[model samples]
Target: MNETPQKSQELKKVAECLYRNGNKVYFALVKVRGKQIKRSLKTDDMAIAKRRLAELREKAERLHGKENKNIRFEELAENWMESIKASLKPKSHDRRRVAIVGLTPFFKGMPVKAVGFAEIDEWRRKRGASISARSHNIELETLKNLLRYACDRGILMDNRAEDFKRRKQPKAVVDVLTRPQFQVLVKALYASPIAVASGAAAMVEFLAYSGMRVGEAREVRFCDVNFETNTILITSGESGTKNHEERTIPLFPNLRNLIQRIKAARPTADANDRIFQIDSPRGALPAACKRAGLPHFSVHSLRHFFASNAIENDVNFKVVAGWLGHSDGGMLVAKTYGHLRQEFSATMAQKMTFEGLSDTPPTFAVVRDAAA
Candidate 1:
């Protein structure tokens, strides 16, 4: 056993211990044949420097996936966010920022893969009544999308978010104002400031008359209207559309006149300029409502009003769907507005009641038959 020390046969000393900034560190350089290939296993660990280099060599030989061990979740998320930021629109990017900030606290130290259903449930439970169910769902969906991005890049093992379920939304009826109610609201808007009523009088009138979405109505420029054809083109916008496709909607004669009047009143009206140029709908809409002495009806109510009026007037559901720029005619007209359609059916039933009674033949009297 003592004879083994006779030949400490020229160990290659491939790995070396080094000191930098007074911290013990390890690095190894390996050269093979004429290639002079080099590999560095840089670590803060001095004792394990040689061992770390060997592991790296084995990993390289296997040629599996890259080893970014000790990578932080924040790092992967940051990397994924670059492309996402570029892809998202300005408003969308801002919304995503809020969602991310709300979600990050729950999973700060955890690996992306470790964020599964159990963690989501725990987070939701702890959140309690602070956030609405719909808001909670939005934040949850944002997390899911991030996980999906990681999975696509092979950075995550699985999208654990898929296992989580959304909270059920209560079936509250969406708000809609009747025609007379909306007229009262508009009167209140008339007394409000430009900041309070910025283009809303026109917006409400337009959406109610033309059945256009708020986003679509806001994007129309003066040039988009054709006086000769009497058509309004909802093709141009700063952001993409709800349906992501443009459509030419017939301008209701009344709506066209209202828009014209609004344009005439505006100091800055250009052929190519945004028709409704204001900071935000939120600024003016509420003030206008207060001044008009009317309830603050969201502009989206105009959409609901349009649907109700359409059903009442017996306008075909498909026609209403197209005017609203919905891809699914059935969903837009039938599903959400089925109750309105029932009112139409009720009107028809009234018409047939008297007619059915009159159309029936009178029965012969039993007394007359007994006398015979």
Candidate 2:
């Protein structure tokens, strides 16, 4: 028979004693907000049951900050994700999905507040030995973000990822081309007989010259080109937008002249047509490398090459960072390109004429005795 829960009726504790397992299980039938609630205390002793009773009393006392009864972390995660997904971009939404991919299994059915350092450490342990530090570090950052989301929505009391003790990995350094190398690459780009049509030559040259991203170059339109002001308008779209922030970059006279030459050849490109359609900006350089017989170059490396050249030539780091569309102030410039300055300084040290240093003739001019 079903019985209604009441605060006045006085709840009863039921104990089930098992002889085979030598375990004693205990539960209480009580009323909370006029509904009957049965909570089981899984233990094998009276002392444990008594301790659990004290814990239940303490939990009941702290109603404001405790995790909700029977609510799972996965359920909370689902609710939290729905609120943020509507505000993020498709790419950003996809990235968030990636952050949570390898994390779902461990914390799925657990309570929102149950995730702690120990549980996280166990999840990481299951990943086994082959995991790289870089990827694991990214996972840690992602886990922190999820906990931060939980705390923001009153699902968790605190962000515990801050307390985690993991070793920080040094960032990977990307190589940039020196001035002679960049010049060689540019010359190699324009070497082909049909280079004008390939436009790979023009595209890479513009990237090297202007420091524009490859996608930005591809999505650039005719109307965005301001010959009078010598500027290129980087409009926002799915094809090429830097985190959806639109900004204009000024063009140099040399770049403008190259644009005119390209325009003279094409002559019929509409104001909004795609600029580089012959090949992907990424693939162009590899093909160019095969032809030029030079070391392979990545599209991103061209931008790095430009930035390093600017810094080596005594251009301000802030100016270089802005020209490269880096949003993280000039930290990228400071961290990566600072090493190139040493090589540049070394070049300066070796720049002297032989006019005054050695007017004396070589000792070979004075024939020595063969017996000596």
Candidate 3:
């Protein structure tokens, strides 16, 4: 009789029960109606676990009920985020996680079925007012992906977020540093006593010449360099690449010289060790720009400078695209750098010359005599 009473008391306080499984703690023994329920609260904090217990119980009540009115946008998003985290790189995972933060304030506790196209459109309109169209599109895309995941998992009848229109993004103007500006920036990097002596100038020059993204530059290893071929092998490192492809780029003279000096500084450095292990020269770069009185540009602008310069130098479009690791076979290069190509072509036209051409075409009489 006493044992039966104890069992009844335990069941009555189901939400307070907890258990540990391996290193992870879970809220266990939750019962709703005739069913038992357990869930991973995903944390060990007692306060957090208590809070989550209430939410879980509410979730169970709705899931078990005939009305099924408690399924929430936050719940679906949490499930979706967990499913995709393993497949994404750390940086990408963080980006998706950040997108959800903005979404949660408005939609977190709302039912999935309750959210409609108009609500999403209104959110897009309001979000676009403060952020760039590209940034707004990313947030919108994240919301759509979450809803689609819910539909795929049978949590929603359909994904209404998919019907929402994406904000139209304007064509971005590509800004590049001219040679004089690049020289000034380089001078600034080295002029600072704080700048690392291990090829800071070379690093800047390499990006300007090689068209390598900053991340790609940081991942470069000494073994990737081929002194004989005058080329550096570009590979998708552990983080993967922007397009998940690999290609080669010419190791320009200044970059090669700087790399040699860096290698000499670390004579025992392993071939697998990164050639230049530096973070974005954000501090040094911007400070240098300020001192030089040049307009601010990002590290990526160096790559644009390389591409623009290559186009102006009449490098074949296909060749330039390949060197830049673009898989589109130069279509994107043509779109972004076509105007530079036109400028170069016009400049070339002014100097056009023929080695073997008469000052004037043969007269019609001379042509008739030859025919006769």
Q: Highest lDDT, which number?
A: 3
Which pairs, if any, clash in model 1?
188-292, 196-284
lDDT (tens digit, per residue) of candidate 1 on 289-358: 7776677777677788887887788888788888788888657577778887787788788777454366
TM-score of each: 0.70, 0.68, 0.72
lDDT of 1: 0.69
Q: In candidate 3, which residue pairs clash?
A: none
C-alpha-based local distance difference test score of model 3: 0.77
Tens digits of lDDT, candidate 3, 1-372: 587655433422323566544444555557777767666677767678788777776655544343444678888788788999878877788889888987787786788777887777677777668888887888988998987776555445446787877878898788779889998898888787667665555677777867888788888899999999998988857776677777788888766887888888889999999877675565567777899999997788888899888888778889888888888899999988888888888988989988789888886743456556
Error of 1 at 106 (Å): 1.5
- Give candidate 3's TM-score: 0.72
Error of 3 at 77 (Å): 1.2
lDDT of 2 by residue, 1-372 (tens): 333333323434444321112123565444434544455666657677767766654444433333464467677667666777867766776666665666677778887678888888787787524456765666677678777876665555457787765556677777777678777777876776566456887888777777777767777777888888888888544644665677777786666877887788778888777666654456557776777677887988878877876887888777787777778778878888877877787888798656676777767677889999
Query: What lDDT does each candidate get?
Result: 0.69, 0.69, 0.77
Find the 10 residues in a row with the least total lDDT in model 1: 14-23
Give the better candidate number (1 or 3) by TM-score: 3
lDDT for residue 163 in candidate 1, whole number 0-100: 82
lDDT of 2 at 152: 60
